[model samples]
Every structure is written in C-alpha cells, then in structure tokens.
Target: MTTVQSARGPLDTADLGRVLMHEHVFVLTPDSQRQWSDEWDEEEQVANAIVKLNELAAQGISTIADPTVDGLGRDVARIARIQAEVDLNIIVATGVYTYCDVPNFFAFRGPGIIPGLDDPMVDFFVRDLEEGVRGTAVRAAFLKCAIDHHGLTPGVERVLRAEAAAHLRTGAPIMVHTHPGTQTGLEVMRVLGEEGVAFERVILAHSGDSTDAEHLGSLAEAGFLLGMDRFGIDATLDFESRVAIVVELCRRGFSGQMVLAQDAACYIDWIDPMFKGALPNWNYLHVLGDVVPALLERGVTESQVDEMLVGNPRRYFGG
Candidate 1:
C-alpha cells in the first residue's frame, strides 16, 4: 500500500497511478487570452476545460495539479465541481505568479515589493488553506511561485519570500515555475534553506528544459524535487531529447528527486491562436502508453519511470 500524506489527508499512491504535476484546469481571462488574441465566452471556456479533464480521466490519470494562482482564475469551486464530476483528485495552488509588470494592487501599496511569504500575504495564504480556496469547498494543497530566467527581480524575490512564509505556516510544499538553463531554481532553494524550510518541500519545476545536467544534479543533491513536467512540447526539442536528459540524470545517480508530466494544456491554442504550429500531445495515456514505452526501449527502466512519475511527485505533493 503506497501512500503519501498530504495536508488535506493521506493520498493513496495507487490512486494516482500516473499523474501530471504541472497543468491548469480553467484559467480564462482577458489578460491571459491576450496571448491568443481573441475573446472566449465563459461557458465555452468551462466546457473546454471539462472536455480536457474528461479526456484525462478516461486515460487513467487519477490525479492532476492545477497550479494556477489567485488572480489567474484559480477557481476552486469550479475545479471542485469538475473533480466531483470527473472523479479525479485535483490539487490546486495558492500563491502569486511573477511577471515583469506587477499588478496595480501590489503597486499601489508598495515602496518595496511584497514578499510572497511575508506577513499579511502569508496570512492570506494561510487563511485560504485553513478556510477554503476562493471561499469554496476545495483547499489548496500546494504553494506555487515563479522565478524569471534572469534571476529573481525584487518583485519575484518578494513573492519567493512570501512562499517560504506560507511553507513555514502550513508545510504544504512549494512549486516553482523556472526558466530553463537559469539558476533561479538554485536561488529558490538557497532562499528556502536560509529560511529553515527543508529542500524536500520545494519542487524545481521545468528543470528538464535545460540540457545542463550538472545544474540539475546539484539541485537534486541538495534535496529539492526536480520537475521534468513538460514532456511533449517538441518544436523546440523532441520527446527523445527530453527523455535523454532524464536518462542522463538517472545515470548520474539523481533519479530520487525527479518527477515527470506533459504540462500540456488545451488552452494553449486559446492563449495563442497564432500558435498553429504543432503542439505537444495533451493526452495522458499517450504519455504513459507511448512515451514511457519509448523511454523503456531506449534502456530506461520501469523503476526509473516510477521514480520520476510516481515517487518524486508523491513525496513533493505529500501524496
């Protein structure tokens, strides 16, 4: 009976037979859709999300982490409804995302950037965890934050600090959206370590995008969970290359800290209607049936797959 304890309660690892750590449920907003260049009606958007979730459920994926933050339409009520309908364990997030432009609310109140895990903001996150997400029945099981490619801006640093504060309060774990080949993941670990937060409680997301095996090895050695979540986005690099990186990392004796997911969202087309280019396949079964089998053919073992897909995620999300 493989099980990992989450802040919500104990989660059966068997229930999460195969899981995707980085994904979104329903994030439709004018600003978010600007990348797509067209407006979407709320009903259509919700229906699209339902279609995707149903697809995932049919493919044998038992759990998904929808890492959308507060302002990005992190609709907990809607997500809970979908979870009940689809019968999938949907873990949501509570934190803020980092962008070059700070929101007006943050700008008006600040001479300095607010730390993500700071006093009032930390209180807000803790309150959401204690009460309910967005005043709905769903509760956030993880804290999501981001670091830009160029190192932490003062604004991002504030958010990272706030994330750390939330970890201190709830011990729910933190997930970072990092730029590939950047040291921002390392920097996040450094800050969290300084704050007395255990490295095991932080997930360095998108670390696989970088071919720098040494950098990833170092983070894994430091005890942070490494997220190789973007599996099938092949325009920049093919699936083989991504699996090669994971295989290489395992060869270097760092399999213990690795996790895998496709990170494909159906809304990519909505976000960028101009992105008519080939998109990675979002079907979870394709990954489990095809991608994993291909990796196995390339000499990657079932154990390594288990480490990346099951063990590391179970540990990071506390199952």
Candidate 2:
C-alpha cells in the first residue's frame, strides 16, 4: 500500500480523503514574533488551532496538505501537538519559501558561493521527506518552493533547484508558489523540466489569481495541477471571477487537472488581526460552504467537484 506521511504519522494514501491541497495551521514570522510581538500566546494559539481544524474535520475534510516550511515558520513539534487534539490528517511539506534570495543561513555555503561544495538544501529536504523534520517523527509528504514576481534571482533559483533535486531523490511531488500574473509558471516549467522533474508532479499554486483562461489551459494541458486556491481572498481576484474561471475550466474538461483550496490558515502573523475581518470567508470551511455551492449553481457537476477536491489531490500524492 502506498502511504504518505502526516503530522501524526504515516497513513495509507487512500485514507487521505477530501483533501484541501493547500492550507496552514499557522503562518508565523518566528523571529519577529519572538522579539517584537506580545500578542502570541502558545497555549491560546494551540487551542484556537485545534478548534478551527476540528471545525474543518467536522465539515468532512480528512486531510490538509500544509506547505508551511522553513521560511514560513514550520514547527513540526508544535504541529504534532495540535494534531494530537484533532482527528484530521495534516500533510506537511519541506522546502524554503522565498521569492528573491536564499535565506542568509544559506548565503555563503552551497554551490557558486563555495567552488567545490554542494547545495545543502537538497540533503535537508530529502532528509525531511525520507526521515523526519526538525528531529520529529513527522516526515514531510511533499516538496514546496516559491518563485514570485521577483522572478528567479540567484537565491530563488537555488531553492527551486534544491526542491527539484529533493523531488528526484524522494519522488515527493512538488508545489510551487507561483506568480501567475507574470506567467512565472513558464519559468518553473523550464527549470524543473531541465532538472528531469515531470510537470505532472508539479502544482502551480495561485493559478486562480489569473483570469487568463488560455494561459491556464495551456499549463493544465502541459500536465501541471492548477491550484484554484485562495478562494476567499477577493482582494487579488474577487469571488465571482474565481468561481467563473473554475466553471469555465470544468466546461472545457480540465477538472481532472485542477485542485481546490482556500490557502487559509488559522493564524497568519503577516497581517493585522483586525484587517482579517475584511476577508470573512477566508477560512477552511469556505470551500465547502460557499465555493462548492457557487460552482454547482453555476453548472459544475458533482463529479467535477469530486475530481478537484478528491481525485486530483490523491493523484498528486500518488494515492
């Protein structure tokens, strides 16, 4: 049986039912929080996360593939604590999350910086997938990297290449936080393709931010899973447009090539908590309560919904 690692332990991939391809229990700037913030309360935050995730599980979401890694402030031990209180399967990932440069931790070591040295990120990522993350038993189930509008700087390229190398070593599928507005997915195709990583195993996240159907179709046809996530974040692209694009793609027979998510998190330290009120539906249950209803009302069949929410994610993880 093919199994995938979750925050709790290894579970049969078949058990990873109704997955939200992208979601986070928490997204923190640990350094900033430690030094400059007094709002963070470990006990309260952990309890809040359990309450929110339990609500998601009660909504029938069996798994949430969280891509919170190094740059996003991953804490596997803390995640395991939250997992112990919830019955949901949380699939964590390994890879750096940076748009412009590698973190200073990698600045002088690896590759071009040191003439004869290798990229240590590849080994770290592989170890996270093959063994565990941060000395904890929760092994990462997939690889994640980012290439935003800043494009591929030396640091960005290093992270992407390291992610590809890790994928090649562990067969863990990849998820790239792409900036589709600038068509950065094209860069991902070129780079990962050269690394011998199959496009079918890559997820071009935030593809829903772009309403260019032709561009989306081309990428889907090229075998990359389009993440029509960020459902409730209407600030980038409103709800109507996001739903319309998905309906159109399903009408064009691309449901098999897409995955759905809110990209929501219980707590994100980037934004002011008061500002979060502006995005009321930007939570885990928005997909089930709002998006699915909107899709069906707009003529998306139940089978197409299943393909995006269930089958596509399963296939992504080799279930």
Q: Which residue pairs come into collision in candidate 2? A: none
Residues 1-319 of candidate 1: C-alpha lDDT, one tens digit per residue: 6443322344675666667788776555646566655566656766776777787777767678778885565667666666666656777788887644344566645344543322456777777666666557666778888887768776677778877888888878898888767578877877787888898888888887878888888888988888887777777567778888888888888888887777765564344555645563644545675677877887778888887777777777665
Model 2 lDDT per residue over 1-319, tens place: 7888899998888788899999989999999999998888999999999999999999989999999988998898999989999979999999999999889998888785885578999999999999898768889999989999999888888889889989998999999999999999999999998999999999999999999999999999999999998999998899999999999999989999999999999899999877989998899999999999999999999999999988899889987
Q: Estimate every model's Cα lDDT from 0 to 1.
A: 0.72, 0.93
| TM-score of predicted structure 1 | 0.87
Identify the candidate with maximal TM-score.
2
lDDT of 1: 0.72
Task: Report how far residue 11 has shifted in candidate 2, in Å.
Answer: 1.4
Evaluate model 2: give its lDDT.
Answer: 0.93
